[model samples]
Target: MTAPARYPVTVQFGEVNGEPATWAIETLPEALAAVPLGDHGVFIVGAVDPDAFDESDVSVLELLAANAVAAMDAADRRRRLRTYEDALKNVDDMVCVLDGDGAVTYATGPFVSWIGADDLGDVAGRPLDALVDEADAPRVADAVAALTDAATEAGGAPEPTRTVDLTADRDSDRRSRHGELRLSRLSDHGAGVVGSLSDTTDLRRTRTELSAERDRFRRLFDRIPDPVIEVVLEPEETVIDGANPAFEAQFGVDETTLRGRTIDALDIHDDRLGDP
Candidate 1:
């Protein structure tokens, strides 16, 4: 931001040259006329006689340079924004940007697809709650608000919210899709919050089904008429982890006493362990 000696620079941010102020003036023998645009080029106006142009002309050059610098900076910002938009379009997971009030300012393709919007226009300006069900909407809004508030704190750094499950708005069939949401405060969001969402409905359903299968197996194990127990075979000993109802009843030992205990530590008579 500092100006050059005598010449007064309006804007230049590439790199600082160690060249002295007298360097430019020394290039031209006649009137005060020598300007270095950048490392590659120099503008030297040497008049046949002295006093060809006044100090006013130099001020005009400074103004021109400043304007060019401003224009370059604006163009750079536009280019970066285009690149970001392109990236968001190709992403499968959703990215949401909320304003300070927890309203959607920007949304990625995934979010747009979920809301059945043809484009961002239909999705933008909506509250974060619009994507999630009523019960989950409040939790999402509160997390975003908390991060936005934390970012404004005097000297504290805002932390991302823990990944939580969110149920999407019910579809025509009244079926809900689940997603894992993580909220954060990014510099790009300014005073707002950024939310990342990954669809986990299929994974969640698989886990639930697996849990049900385990429960059915447990019930079958308990109904076995013979004394049955499940044990972990360790290097040193077999450890009892589970015992069926018949085993627990015949052994006259509670499930808690049998669990986590090695067979040698149980002190059961040898006749009782005949089948084992």
Candidate 2:
């Protein structure tokens, strides 16, 4: 393998052997002629006719240098952007990109983890609605279409953001994930739309669990054997929705009187019912 390069080098305009019009540069002759430099050691001069020096020559050199710098800058910028994009693709969550027409341009990660085999493999350039559940697909499609329309109509400013759920196939398994889909205008070109998607299955699962827990509590309150009572205002009466067999035997009161009866008239002084 070739050895590493040495220290850095600097170049700038300077006198070429005391001849102001005799243009030359200072640099190693073997290094690169494409780069403006004087000579191989210290500084050197290149012979150019004095009459050739003109405003046009200066402008040409300036343009050449500017073009070179711009090319180099563009190359570096592209390299960095590619590196960042690769990193994003490797992320754990499913990521999908969509165009202005709601067609998927790219898909990565385990989309099937939440959505089972929905034929997501040949997904490139396919509309997102196909992979989504029928119930939720139209809602999400309308939202995305609206975003694209607004983006086109919205002179320069970016369109407002929106989030929606979507489905996809992953590894022969059909899964349903809470996908957060975002719609944004891609730069100033206005040629297409760029979409970003993230999986939120865990959040949805947690919400479902909370709903189940609330239902469980309601069931317990309504079906328990204890003589649970509820008080009502306005008429000031008590309602008995739940009671055990022992409640009637111990209180010596019929079920009818126990329900919708004014508590003050019952005169329940027994420590068995409450602490009297």
lDDT of each: 0.69, 0.56
**Model 2 worst lDDT run, 10 consecutive residues:** 37-46
User: How good is model 1 by TM-score?
Assistant: 0.63
Q: Model 2: per-residue lDDT, tens digit, 34-93?
A: 334222122222333435445676566656666666565555545554554476577765
Candidate 1 per-residue lDDT, tens place, 163-236, comes to 55787666688667888888776544335566788888899999999999999989999998988888999998
The C-alpha stretches of model 1 lying farther than 4 A from their native spots are 1-86, 150-157, 172-174, 233-237, 273-276
TM-score of each: 0.63, 0.43
lDDT of 1: 0.69
- Model 2 alpha-carbon drift over 4 Å, by segment: 1-87, 112-121, 149-158, 167-178, 188-194, 223-275
By lDDT, the best candidate is 1
Q: Weakest 10 consecutive residues, lDDT, candidate 1?
A: 20-29
